[model samples]
Target: MPLFGRKKSEDPSALRWSREPLPPTPEPGPDGLRSMEDHRDYLLSCLTELPPFSQHLLDALDLSICEDVYSAIDMPRFDNSAMDGYAVRAVDVAAASAEHPVSLPVVGEVAAGQDALDRLSPGTAIKIMTGAPLPPAADAIVPYENTDRGASDVRVFAPSVVSQHVRYVGEDIRAGSQLFAAGAQLGPRDVGLLAAIGRDTVLVRPRPRVAVVSTGSELVEPGQELGHAHQIYDSNSTMLAAAAKAAGAQVYRVGLVSDDPESVLQVISDQLVRADLILSTGGVSQGDYDVVKAVLPQLGETDFTAVAMQPGKPQGFGLIGDDRVPMIMLPGNPVSAFVSFEAFVRPAIRKLMGVTPYTRPVVRCRATHDFGSAPGKRQLARGIVSLDADGGRLVELAGGHGSHLLGDLARANAIIVLGEDVTQVATGDDVDVWLLDEVS
Candidate 1:
C-alpha cells in the first residue's frame, strides 16, 4: 500500500510507452536546452530532507556530522616532549658549549605514556624520549645531538632555550572548544583528531540508501556465456551501484531486469521500503521495449525528459511512493551512465548527507588535443588531466566521443566541460576540467 497511490490519467493513450509513435519530447528550455545546472537543480528540489545522524564510530569514514562536536578535554591533555632529549633547567645549560662541555647527573628516565613523578634537582637532568611527559621543574630540553646521548649522565654542549621542544597542554585545541562544526565530513585527519580527544563515537548523518537496477532484455551478466546474438553485458547497474557507494551512499544492486513491464513494476515496488533513492538504466529511452517508461508512471509521480548534454541526454527523475523517494533514470550506455553519475548523482548524494563543497574540484588546464563538440549541447568529454614536465597542467582527450565507449571511461581521470557556444577546443586552449579522482 505504501507504493500504490498515483493520480490516474483519464486518457488511455497517455499511458503508452510503445515505439509506434514515441511520446513527444518536451520543448527545450529558454537557454537553448535544459542546462546541466538546471537539471541538477530540479533533481535537488524534488529530494526532501534525509534523516538525521545516529552515533557512528570514528573508524567510519566519509560520514558527515549532524551537530557541532566539542572536546571535553584539551588536546595533548598534558605537557609532553616533542623529541628525544634531556630535560634540564635553562640556566644550567646556559654557559655550556662544544669546546667547554658541562656534565649533569641523569636523575631519571621518562618514556612515553609513563608519568614523571621525580622533580629535577638543580645541576641534574632527565633523559626523555619523544612524546614523554616533561619532568616537573624542567624548563628546557637539550637535544641528544647537543649532548653525549648518555643514560647515566649527559653532557650539554650548547645553551638550551626555554620551553624548547615542549608541547604544552591545550596547544593544538583547548578544552570545551568546538572541535568540528556541524556538517563536517570526517576524513583521516579528522578521525585522528577525534580519536586523540578520546571520542569513541560521534553523531553523523546516515548514509543514503540507494537501490540500482538495469532494465533491458538485451542485457547479460558478466562472466556468463553470451550466446544470444548482440546481448550486451549488464554494466550500467554495476557502474551506478559502485558510483553510489563511492559517493558515500549504501547501495543495493537489484541486478538486471528484462523488458517485461509487469516484472519491472514488481521489482520497483519491492525496493521502495529500502531505498531513499532509486536508480534505473535503459528503459527510459524512446524504444519499443522500454518497460520502465511504460510501468513507472502508473506506480507514482515521475518524469521522463531529454537533457541537452552529449551522451547522457535522455534523463528521468521524480519523487514516488508513500515515502516520496527520489528516483533517477539514466541511459544504458556505460559512458553516459558514468558521466551523468559524476556530474549529477554524486553531488545529489553528497548534498543529501549534508556534505559541503559536494561537487568535484574543477581546474583550468591547457588543452593538448583538439576536441570536437556537438552544436547547441553542453559536452562532458572524457580526458586525461595531468601535469607536464614544466609543472603546467595539461588535458588531452581520453577516447572517442561515443556513449558506448567503456574503455574511454575506464581511462579517463577528468572531464572536459565544453559549453554549448563552444564547438571545438584547439591545442593550448584553456579548458575547465573536473577532476574525477584524487591527483597528487
Candidate 2:
C-alpha cells in the first residue's frame, strides 16, 4: 500500500489517514511500563482524523484531499499563440529565412485573451501576442527575435513549422480528466493547479485544534517577577504550543494553571469545546504536588504509565470529558517535555490532520563523542548534527544529558537516539538521528 490518504478506516502505516483512526495497538507488559513505540501507537489509536470540509483554496494550505478531483474544462481552452510575433500557415514560412525574408501584410492584431481576427489568406499574416488565440487557418508562429516585428506588416527571418509556438486545447489537462487522486496533499503548487483547473474549494481534513496548558503553583508567566528563589517561569506550554502550531495545529496555549486539583480539572474541562487534543506539562511524577496526575482521573479514563525512556519516563494519557478529547501529560522539566512531544505528540497532531508519514525523518549518522544509556530505557539526547567534509552526517552531543537543560535543547538541531540495551557507544560509532530542524 502507498505510505501516505482517506476514508477514516484506512491504515496510515501502509498509507495516509482518514476521518477515523486505526485500531488499538497492543498493550504494554504486565508492569505497565510502556515502551516508546507502544505509548505512541496507543495514543494514535485513540484519535480520529478531523472530518473533511469544503475549504476555499486560500485557507486549505497543507491539507490532504478527501476525494479525487476532475477538471471540468480544458487547460488551454483553445489553440492560442505561445509567442509575440505572427501566426501563419507553416507552409508559408517553410521557404523563408534570414537571407530570404518573406514580407506579408498585417491584416489585424490580437493580444492575449482577445478573439481571433479574420482567417489568414494564402500568404498574409496576423500579428499576435503570447497567449492570444491563433487566427483561423493559421497553423504556425514566428518569434519576434526571428522576425522584423511590425504592426502593419511583418517579416519572417526564419522558417516556422506547423503548431510551433501554439498551445493547443487540452494540451496540459483534458476536460473531465482526473487532476488529483484521493488522499493527495496540497502544497502551493497543488493549490495553483487546482485554481487553474477552476476549483474554488476542495474537501479536505481540517487542522486539529490543540490546547496546551502548564500546571504548577511555583510556575509563573515568563514576564512576571519571581517572589521566591524556588519559583520558576513556565516554558513548557509556550514551547509545546509553538511546536503544535508548527505542525499545522490550531493552538490554544492556556499558559499557566495552579497546582490545585479543582483548578486543573476546571481549566481542562473548559478546553474540550475547542480542543481535539490536549497537552499538559508537569505534575505527572510521584511528587506530592503532582495534581494533574491526581485530578485527571476524575475527568475521564486516564492512565499514568511509566514509559521506559530517559528524561521523559513519567507519562499520562487520558480521554477527557464527555467528548473524549485525548490529552497527554508531559514531564514538567523542559527537555523531557520537549522530547516526549517529539516522540508522541507531534505524530498525534499530524495524524489528526491526516498528513502522511506523521513522524520526523530519521537518518543514520556517526556520533562525535561517547555516550552511555540506561540498560533498559531508550535515550533521546540533544545533539547538533552536521555534514562532514565528505558529506557524511556527524553528530555531537549539544549539552550534557540533563533533562532540565533548556539552553542545550535550543542549540541542538537533532535528537540522537540511544536504544534500550545500548549501554555505551564509542566515538565514530553509527547512530540513528532524528532531524529536528533544517540543516544548511
Candidate 3:
C-alpha cells in the first residue's frame, strides 16, 4: 500500500510538489496501514537540502562543496632543488668522480626561500639547500654527499644528470585548472590541498542542526533518584542525539518533556531558533497519554499514521513552527526509535546535508538460523552481520525479537529486514539487511 499521500506542505526554501491533483494512494494491505517505504519517501520528499555557506577550509572538513574550485596559482611556482645539493652544470660535473674528482670554486650558498639567482659560471658550483630556488642558468644538482662539505672550494666525486633533482614550475598542477568538483566532500588530504592552493575558505553545505526531544510523564534523568516504581530514566534523547551527530548533524539534546500539551508546545517552539530538523520520540500512538499527537497538529500540519512495521508501527511527521522546520515523531521504545531512525530520520538528515543515497546500504545475506516475524507487518530484527567462510554475507538475530529489548539492540551492529509477507526464515535462507555501520 502507498504510505505517502500527495504532498500539500509548503516550504519557501524547499522544492515544492505540484499543486495539480495527484494520483490516488496505492492499494492497501490487509491492515490498511501505509507501508514503511511509502512513509519514508514522504518524509524525504518534504525536506530540502540546507543552503550553502562560506566556511574556512578547516571548518569545511567533511562537508560537500557547493561550487567548483579552480587553482589560482601553479604548484611549484618556480624551479627549486628537490634536496640539499650543489647546483651545477651537468656537463661541468660529467667527468667528476671519486677516482678522478674535479675541483671547482663554490661561488655562493643558497638556502630555501632565497630568490637570488647568481648565474652558474662554467666549472663553478653553488651550494644549495633543499627547496632553494635554482639559479637562472643552472641545469642540474650534485648532492652535497657527492662533494666535500666545504664552505668555499669543493671537490665533486660524482657526475650529475641534467634536470635531475630539479622541480620545475607547474610540475604538479597548473593555474586555472579544476581543483575540486562541486559536491565533493572535504577530507584531510583535501584540506591540505586547499591550503597548498592558497584557499583559506570554501563554499559548502553546512551540517543540519537536529533537536532531539523525549516526552513521557514517567521519564526522569539518568542519574536522578526515581520518584516512583514505574519511572524510568530518559535515554531516548541522548541516544537519538548521538545518532544524529554520527549521521553528520549538529545535535541539541533536549531534556524530558512531560506528557502535557502546553509543555510540549513550548519546548518544541523554543527549539525553532537553532533546529533545522526536530526529532521527538513517544506519544504518537493511540493511547490516552498520546499528548504529542494531539498537541502537534495545533502548531503545524502534522499527521499520525500507522505504518505496517513490527517493533515500530506508529509514526508521525510534519513541518512545524513558524519557520517550518521538519519534525519526525518516533516510538518510545528504544529499539523502535532506533529502527525508525534507520528507516526515516537518518535519510532525512542526509538529505538536509545535501548527500546522495540517503538510505543505509542494504545487502543480500543468508540467515545463520531461523527467525519468526509478525504477520502483516515488516520487521526490523536486531542482529549481527558478518561474512561467512566463503566471504558471503551471514546474519543471526542478536536476541529475541522484542521492541523493548535495548540490550539486544546495543549488541546489534546490523538490522535484519523482513518484508511484510515473510513470516519465517530457515537456516541458509536468503535475507535482506541494512548495514548500520555504513550510515553514509
lDDT of each: 0.81, 0.85, 0.85
Clashing pairs in 1: none
Clashing pairs in 2: 4-15, 4-16, 8-19, 8-20
State in Å the error of residue 282, model 3: 0.7
Q: Write the per-residue lDDT of candidate 2 for residues 1-440, one digit (tens) a residue.
A: 11112122122122221223324445766555789988888888887788788999978888889989999999899999988889899898898888899888888889987888888998988889999999999999989998888878888889989989999999999999998886778999999999998888999888888899999999989888998999998889999999999888889999899998778877887776678898999999999999999877766777788988887999988876555678999999999999999999999988988887878878998988887877788889998998988988999999898999999999999998888879998999999899998776
Better of 2 and 3 by TM-score: 2
So what's the TM-score on candidate 1? 0.90
lDDT (Cα, tens digit) per residue for candidate 1, span 1-440: 12234433343223332222222334567754677877877777665546564555653578887778888898778888888899999999999999999999998899999998588899999999988988899988998889998778888899988998899989989999998888778898888888888887887767888899998888899899997688988888988999899889989999988888777877777677678788888877888887777778766677777788987988887565555567888888889888888877888888777786868877999999777788788899999888889888899999899999998889999998888889988989999899887654
Model 3, C-alpha of 292: deviation from truth (Å) = 0.9
Using lDDT as the measure, name the better of candidate 2 and candidate 3. 2
